[model samples]
Target: MWVYFLLVIAILAWGAHLAWRWKQARDFAPQLLALRQQEGELPPSVSQKEFTDLYLRAEGPRAGTYVYACAAFMTVTLAPVSSLFNSVWTAIWQATGSDPVFEVGTFIHTFSFFLAVMGLTILILAIAMRRYYALMPPNLRQVIRHLKDAHS
Candidate 1:
């Protein structure tokens, strides 16, 4: 009963977290678009909907620190699962009259560090405007180009 209660609480917490992130992204969209306009980063002929859509997609309200923290937490949480699986596999092999499959080392900390670094790198690359814009559909891309031409 207690376990089920805890599970429900955890699910609710996760949902709330997602809602917060979504709201943050939505609310910051206007400001982000405005900043892009001020910096002459936005296309002059773009509509509000188009500008907001691109800005929201490129950058959310959360700071870089929040991204890093989430990455670190994910790495730490999953690290033990890898070790547990390896240990279980080694036990099964030994029971089958075979030698240990591989030597197990305490690499969780190092592994987590490496994972966090890689995760942050990927996140940064994904949020870059150039990469994001490049991946947009042709129609949207054409619209952006028109906006740029109008501004120039």
Candidate 2:
């Protein structure tokens, strides 16, 4: 069926994405640690706790995005794997002429898909916030001010 075909493609894509994210996180660890160390050198006006809080506030959404991305990958792929198990179980049950047990697999598949959608929503919001910070208007305005001052 078309659904099964699409599910297979989705599973492959999710797997690849997860792998790439894992590597990216690994590569970022040292840089993150260095940033944290630099934060410790802040002046007395900024307490270590305040600096840490600000850092977390800035980085929290990005961390959440990665977490949600991983969760989405799992939820998207696991539902169909669960379905495959259910199908095998049904065939085995039929072969033995036994009464079929109550199946919750369909419910799980639906619930997993719902969670995957939520994960995607969170990921989108995080990405938007990340990009917003990347293009910080205030920082750009400061740069423009310095340039104008130099020219004047």
Candidate 3:
């Protein structure tokens, strides 16, 4: 069905995006470490928490974009997944003479429904976090600007 096709495409696109992000992170790691160790910046022996804080500050408002994107993706794909699972359940019911109490299709449908609820929750949380971040002070803007300059 068209839903299945769309689901496949969405999955493939997500996989490609993840692969690209992984490649970018792999390439950027050395530069990020070098930037961290530079004079007047974080020391070579910086603690993990300190480094993470610096990185998050450097990312500024854009840090939440990844979470927003993932939540949106889940929101968009949940319906198709649920539909597919429902179709599977129907097919299995038809193939089997009767619907068993502990059928795989029923389990899959329940799991997919649970995932859909979780995805909706995550989407709502992402939206709330985005609004909260938007209202936060602009102190991190300076860190983001400094990191851009250093990268350039």
Candidate 4:
């Protein structure tokens, strides 16, 4: 019961955090545009599409931090989420007074295990890529970027 309560609290906290971030981003957009205009990074009277493209170009690379945070959070929360799901399913089963065709706990455990594995894999890949990029020579990196642009 305490675990269930804690899980609910954690979920609500995460949702609130996400909402706060979304609001922050929303508030920052116009400011970012204005700043870019002042810095001559963007022309005055830019269209929405042009602003979007510029914003993505400027901010997209930094998204890896968010991805890594999410992956780590997912990996950390695996046990709690699995426990919550199994508890909920067990309560429902007891209320129903009927045997389930398959063991819900087993499925929940397996699903959570796979989710953790995926999260770990993402974290590992991100770390490896970051290290590889950091170690690469600047000239080589620039060449790779040019090749990527040509392909695009």
Candidate 5:
């Protein structure tokens, strides 16, 4: 029951995320094409100003909200495993002691949640990196820069 609930929520979150990504792509089609024409591959992150300008047109906040919700879906699967799974999760945890598998509908819930979490994390990191450039701490920035330079 609880596992099913988590699965449903995660599925919904993924759906929302997909829709938001589609919208972002549609909104940025012109810029996307321009980049492809000039640079070959798309840039990693659009500038914050570019995103902000696009966001201001409408649906920006909604897109951001969807990404955050996706993360919530991921969290729903982990941590305490959800109170809804008290009986099963507790029993399994007790039996296995930290090797608990999600009860019943867990596979779907776990996949959806984990995927959503990754997607949300990517969106946030992209946005932050786009605007702040080096906000992910100096060490991380240096590593990324080194890798990027190496790639180039």
Candidate 6:
């Protein structure tokens, strides 16, 4: 029960981390775009096509970080939990014999669910951030573009 609770907490933390990164990227983007507009190169309100292109370039890498961070966190947090709680889990497994193939299925199901849950969470965050971007003022958005271009 404790191990399961810990796992749940870690999962929630992973979601929070994803949300945080999405907020970071979403906030930074408009700032960068606005900076660009002020410099008179990029426009504030980008066309959908332009926004798509920019999002593809910038959001792609940023999103990867969120995914990897969550993965790393899970790996680290679960390793100790799994190691310490193994005897308990093993006893329960042996006593119940819940399913002959549960040994394999447990691993598959746990990993799959973990990945799927985190992936979906991050995807939703990205979508939300994208929608927010569309509503941002154009000039501010341009500033973000300029700042990004300057950095690169």
User: Which stretch of 10 consecutive residues in model 6 shows the poorest summed lDDT?
Assistant: 135-144
Model 1: residues with Cα > 4 Å off, grouped in runs? 60-152
Candidate 2 residue-wise lDDT, 1-104, digit = tens: 67866866776676576667655655554454455346642223333443334344333344444555655554565567566656765676567675534333
Report the Cα lDDT for residue 150, model 5.
49
For model 6, how does the per-residue alpha-carbon lDDT over 16-45 read when each residue is reduced to its tens digit? Answer: 776686666655665655655588666545
- Candidate 5, superposed: residue stretches over 4 Å from native: 34-152
The TM-score of predicted model 5 comes to 0.25
User: Which runs of model 6 end up more than 4 angstroms from their true locations?
Assistant: 44-53, 60-152
lDDT tens digits, residues 55-78, model 5? 333333444554555455445544
lDDT of each: 0.57, 0.52, 0.59, 0.57, 0.52, 0.57
lDDT of model 4, residue 85: 62
lDDT of 1 by residue, 9-53 (tens): 665566567668767877776675576678877754556776656
**Which pairs of residues collide in model 1?**
none
73-114 per-residue lDDT for model 4 (tens digits): 664676786677677667776777846643564675467656
Superposed Cα deviation of residue 86, candidate 6 (Å): 14
Candidate 2 vs candidate 4: the lDDT winner is: 4
TM-score of every model versus the real structure: 0.39, 0.30, 0.37, 0.39, 0.25, 0.37
Candidate 6 global CA lDDT score: 0.57
lDDT of 3 by residue, 1-152 (tens): 78857776776676667656655655554566566567545445544454446554443334444554565566577677677767776777668775575355467557866776687777677777787677654454455455555545
| Error of model 2, residue 140, in angstroms | 29
Q: With candidate 1 superimposed using the best TM-score fit, by how many Å does residue 99's alpha carbon deviate from the native?
A: 28
Cα shift from native, residue 78, model 4 (Å): 8.4
